[model samples]
Target: MDTLSKLFKNNIRQYGMIIALVVIMLLFEILTGGLLLKPINITNLILQNSYILVLAIGMVLIIITGHIDLSVGSIAAFVGAAAAIMMVDWGWPTWAAVVASLVVGGLIGAWQGFWVAYVRIPAFIVTLAGMLLFRGLTMIVLEGQSISPFPSGFQKISSGFIPDFGSFGTNMVAVVAGIILSVVYIINELRDRRAQLKYNFKVISQGMFLLKLILLVAVINVFTFMLASYSGIPNILILLFVLIVIYSFVMNKTVMGRHIYALGGNEKAAGLSGVKTKKVTFWVFVNMGVLAAISGLIFAARLNAATPRAGTNFELDAIAACFIGGASASGGIGTVFGAIIGGLVMGVLNNGMSLIGLGIDWQQGIKGLVLLLAVAFDIYNKNKRSV
Candidate 1:
């Protein structure tokens, strides 16, 4: 019992946020009269939130390193416009255009990183400047008009669904994928538990572990079942999954990841300990640029156009998702998983409210309140711990 209690305390942030997500989902599900989780709606939710999820992944890393990027939205917009021009106007191949766009994203990150990391400009100021600069560039690139009718291949990046094989009246591919994921999750958890035990680290009781496993398995299966019922998985959903897995591994099992946390915890100390704060900071922003670029492409593809006003206020949503997912306002704390949950929370709220006929204005206000509350909760938790 004591060990279980300790485990719970140690993981309060993760567990709490997850519980809050479940509660919010349930609330919205009920309010929407069961429409929130319908197969079609579930598919739409994943598609709609895919880009935000991508941004949240990168933003969580930025926050983890005790920095923030205010220009991701603008960068995304600019990259989208650039891609549109390359593919639609310049007659570039779809594959080449995407590759070029990602490279541009990286270059843009390097540019901002040079200012923030080596030049000693505050990230806030540099990114603020970047926000304005990129937005203007996007406007100029688009000539204050929208570019449309991207190549069919580019359009498929966002809207394509996986091919379904014959199954028991569902997408057999989705069902099989779900089962595999559930098994993988259980194995990972067990492996983690064994490692904790080997190191004499505290772990939850076996009963609690089993309970968690069951719940996770159930959730994954149900979600996959829904998707199977509809369009089987989306290509974008697969992309998001790959990213989550890769980033989660990078953050949890890599030396660079540890260094990032150390940097955020205490920069001076990290520097004293020989951590290359500047390089790390620079690379972090560069990576942010790459993710933002991917987001831009996805968004543009989904809309089948690039507009001058594309990506307005996207930075806010990404930041909010990171915070709501349990990233510390002061940095040195957060997780990739947390960011996904946070994005989903926002996604669910947006979808549910829209279904119920709530106006966009009300949705914005409510989202603001939720963001405020999440930050407050985090601060309160920190203060309580210090006390």
Candidate 2:
């Protein structure tokens, strides 16, 4: 019992944020008259927030390294415009166009990174400049017009659903995948617990561990059921899942990841400790650019068009998601899972408010309040701990 209490205290922020999310979800779910979690709505929720979630992933890493990228939204817009010009106007192959767009995104990242990392320009100034520069380029590329009617295959990147097969009228593929995922999660948790025990690390009691596993598994199965009832999992969802797994592993298990955290915690110390701060910072921006490009492509595909205004304010949303997800404003603290939870919190709010017939003005105001409160909560905890 004491062990469980200690575990809960140590992880209060994580558990508290999760509980907050659940409570907000429940509140909205009730207010929406069950419309918020309808099978179709659930699918739409994933689709609608997919791009933002992608941005949040990259942004979280950037924030972790004590930096920010205000240009991702603009970069995404530029890439989307570039993709549209290539595939629609120039008749390039969809695959080739995508490759080229990603390359362009990388190049853009490299450009900003050069100034920020090596030239000693602050990341804020560099990305802000990039934001303006790319937004202008997007307008020039599109000539203040929208490009549309991309190839059918290009559209599939965002709109396609995994095909269903096997017995039962439902999507057996989704069901099976859900079961496999649950088992894998359980195994991983158990393995981690065993490793902790071997290292003589403190861990939650067995009963609490079991309870956590059950709750997680139940949530997974319920979500899978929703998707199975619809048209199976979405291609974008698959992409999101893959990204989450990969980034989570990278941040939690890789040396580079630790270096980033160290850099964020104290750049001078990290550099003295043999961390290549410049290279890490440079690569971080480069990664951000690539992700922004991919997000741009997904956004463009979902809209079936590229417009000059595409990705406007996306940087704000991504930054907000990272902070709301438990990322520190001063950096050196965050998690990939936390970012997802934060994104979902925002996503659910958007969907729920829309369902309840709230106007955009009210929605924005309420979202701002929620973001403020989340950050305030984080600060309060930090201060309390210090005290």
Candidate 3:
């Protein structure tokens, strides 16, 4: 009981949001008469939320360094417009267009990174300027028109699904993959537990650990099953998964990650500790630019059009997801998994409200309320910890 209490207290934010997500899903499922979790809706939900999720991943890193980027939405829009022009107006090959778009995104990031890192400008001002600057550029590039009908191959970047060579009704491959992942998850959990014990670290009880594994495994299988029911797996979903895995690894296991956290926790101290604060901050923005570019492509591909307003309010959503996902406003604290969970919470809320015939105005109001409450919850936790 004591161990359980300690564990719960330690991870209350994560556990709380997860429970809230399940409750939200269930409530919507009941309200929408089962439409919320339908295989097709679930698939659409993922497709709709991919860009925000990608941006959230990058946003969390920036926030962790005690900074923010308001220009992501504009960056996404500008890059998408550029790519559209490359493919549509210039007749560039799809692959080359994509590469060029990502490069453009990187250059944009580097430009902002220079201002924020070297010039010692505040991130908010820098990104705000960038937001206005890039939004105008998007309109200028597209000449206030939307471009459409990308190559089918280019379209696949966002809308394609994994092929299932062997399936009966549902995708058997997805089910098998789910099973394999569950086994792997269990192995990883047990290994982690053993390592903690070997290090003489304080650990949860055996039963608690097992219960945690069981719940997570159930989630993995169920999530895959639902996706398998409609389409095996989306290409974007695969990309999101790969990204989550890579970023999570980078955050928890790498030196650069440590420097970022340190910089966020205390810029002066980090610099004194030989962290190269400017370099770290600069690189983080550069990474954000790349991710934002990637998100722009995903959005454009999903819509099959590049428009002037492609990424309206995207920066706000990404920032909101990070905060709701348990990222600290003060920096030096957040997780990739937490950011994903936060984005899903927003996604589920949007889907649920739309299905229940809620008006867009009300949806915005409710989402804003939810964001406020999540941040309030974080503050409460922070205060309690300090006490």
Task: Give the distance in Å from residue 91's predicted Cα in candidate 2 to where it truly belongs.
Answer: 0.9
Across residues 64-181, which tens digit of lDDT does each residue of candidate 3 receive? 9999999999999999999999998899999999999999999999999999999999999999999999999999989999998788999999999988975489988788889999
- Candidate 3 has a TM-score of 0.98
Model 3 lDDT, full chain set:
0.95
| lDDT at residue 195 of model 2 (Cα atoms) | 100
Candidate 1 local Cα displacement, residue 285, angstroms: 0.5
lDDT by residue (190-283, candidate 2, tens digit) is 9999999999998888888999999999999999999998888999999999999999999989999999899999999999999999999999
Clashing pairs in 3: none
Order of candidates by lDDT, top first?
3, 1, 2
Supply every candidate's count of residue pairs whose N, Cα or C atoms clash at under 3 angstroms.
0, 0, 0
Candidate 2 local Cα displacement, residue 67, angstroms: 1.2
In order, candidate lDDTs are: 0.93, 0.93, 0.95
Model 2: how large is the Cα RMSD against the reference? 1.1
TM-score of each: 0.98, 0.98, 0.98
Off by over 4 Å in 2: none
Encode model 1's per-residue lDDT on 241-317: one tens digit a residue.
99999999999999899889998999999999999999999999999999999999999999999999988988999
